[model samples]
Target: MDISAEKLKQLRLERGLSQDLLAKQSGLSLRTIQRLEQAGGGSPESLLALSASLNVSPQALRHSSVPTISHWSFAQRSVQLSALLLLLALLLALVSLASHGQFSIYLDLVSLLFLLLFVPGVTLVAAGPMGLIMSIINLSLLWQHATGSLAERRFLQQLYQLQYRLCYGSALVLSLLGLVSVFYHSPHLSTASLQGALGVLCLGWLYAACAAELLLRPVLFKLNVSIQAEQHTLAN
Candidate 1:
């Protein structure tokens, strides 16, 4: 917010320190420290790093410039807020597309797109496609998610993330099999091959879904993980 803080932010960014990395080293939450940089008020620990590592003063860090998002930025919360907005945009876009569209061959493309959006792709796998009404409900739930606190939001995020991943995964597998089926020769189509492909695909989707749910057990409450979040217990 201030000139000095802006400069400090710029310097921090130039050093290539992530908010998480900085927080890990400085004993603070990534969010809180990020808020400081945005507010042009980094922690004393951050200041120490800046002064010692960057040869700047705490006063200078405060009055330097706006603490930016990266090693080059320390000026404004550009990197931090931009990342937040980026994820928000990506999630909203996915939700929007999934909510009010037909599951055509195009959706396979969308699923592939979703896979590319996240790292270590193909996390969630869903077999049943959501109908129009279900899509509305899902989008509505996602929009309402914005009003909650961090923990609440994290849960919703986990839910949607897993949901999309599953859908994408299912779509991916189905698309591949569909490709395989179309590739070779099949004038009338054999019962055995069809059954085998269909069976294997179903089992794969089911297994992926269970595994994703189990892996993200904390964010996703299966059988109500008994998390004392807010004031009530949650059920997945």
Candidate 2:
């Protein structure tokens, strides 16, 4: 059966078992262990063996790790749907704006991709490769344990915290660079030069604001709500 590779890796890590050790403990081959963790395909017997070794139920290794839509309250579902629709609306609006037939200095496919990549790229450069890698690992761990552990909730909070910081930081960096360029070339700055520098400044802030408001914030809200609801249920 198809299982959750993330969940499997999480369980193994939580138990402090290396792949080689886990294979020996589970009586499965090392290659099988790697394959299961990478692509999540194994028989029922393999699942049972891994579960026994990991001290979790076989179902826990399956793909039903996260809370599903059916488990959410009506209000939660409505909020999620609204968030999704809002994203779609924002996307359509962007498409409409770009398709207005008038030439734009910045509204094109290349610029869109650059805007999307720039924040994370700059963040990685600023935070260092190792920091970004660890953050990603924490994010993956957060995905499965968000509602199950307080530590994971802390990570969830940190997730959005990092999101906004990167967004604003990138925007501010670009704006400052733009201003520096404008000042450096002040004596010879033509209309096109002024517009180009200002475009960098404006696009930086615009993309950052849109990403925070339309994408990251909504996702963080949903996860926070789900975590709170799960905690409330456990408390009661």
Candidate 3:
């Protein structure tokens, strides 16, 4: 296997362990550790042993040997863009049907403002500033991935997973809050109040599903494919 000598040495040093100590802990000979650290290749068993001793995954100890494409071809760009547009069109069609052909209901400023504010606001509050910032940075990395950028699979995976969890979590919170509001006013609940509560539930669910399906799922699938391909390449 192709191990990363620098990463191995760095991991060992970060844990404040000497080469001999790492070798002893991993149950490998000191010479084997020295050779692996001096060079970059090792058997999978050696890689696994080192990873276990270092408290890091085997993948973390390996290097990205595949060179990433700096730019995508025109056809690749067109296909990606077309898929995005088609998904948008489908979403619009579904929304129109759900609204009984009144697609303009979705264009109402109040609902739009509520959606624009609620999801991100809740995510920010829930994840805190640094977490939100990292998620945003990872989101940008995901955009780069779409442009034939094959680096940072780890960050891209984190971006989608974080957003996916936070989005659904926020939606559920919104729905529960709305339900609480309705229940609190049940004694004097009017038609308008009922409608408002239902709207909140529906909008929260709709926004979460839209965000997940349109953005998170595709990036997650792409990341999975990239990781699998990387593993296959490394194995070969």
Q: CA lDDT, every prediction?
A: 0.46, 0.69, 0.70
Tally clashes: model 1: 41
TM-score per prediction, in order, is 0.27, 0.52, 0.52
For residues 1-236, could you state the per-residue lDDT of candidate 1 as single tens digits? 13244664577688787767666765667775666666654434556654665665556655433222243224223433544475576557667776777323123343344334432332223322333223224344312212334464455555556554655466466657655864464555587866654554444444344334433332233112212222231110
User: Per-residue lDDT of 1-236 in model 3, one digit per residue for the tens?
Assistant: 67888999999999999989998999999999898889877787888899899888998999876455334335345545755886889787878777796664444354445556665675677667766665565555335553344455665566568678766776777778778878898779888878866775777667777677666666676566666555654453
Model 1 vs. true fold: TM? 0.27
Worst 10 residues of 1 by lDDT: 227-236
At residue 180, candidate 2 shows an lDDT of 88
RMSD of 1: 16.9
Better of 1 and 2 by lDDT: 2
> Which regions in candidate 2 have their CA more than 4 angstroms from the true location?
1-75, 108-148, 230-236
| 124-181: candidate 2 lDDT, tens digit per residue | 7766776566445544422232344656555556656676677777677767766887
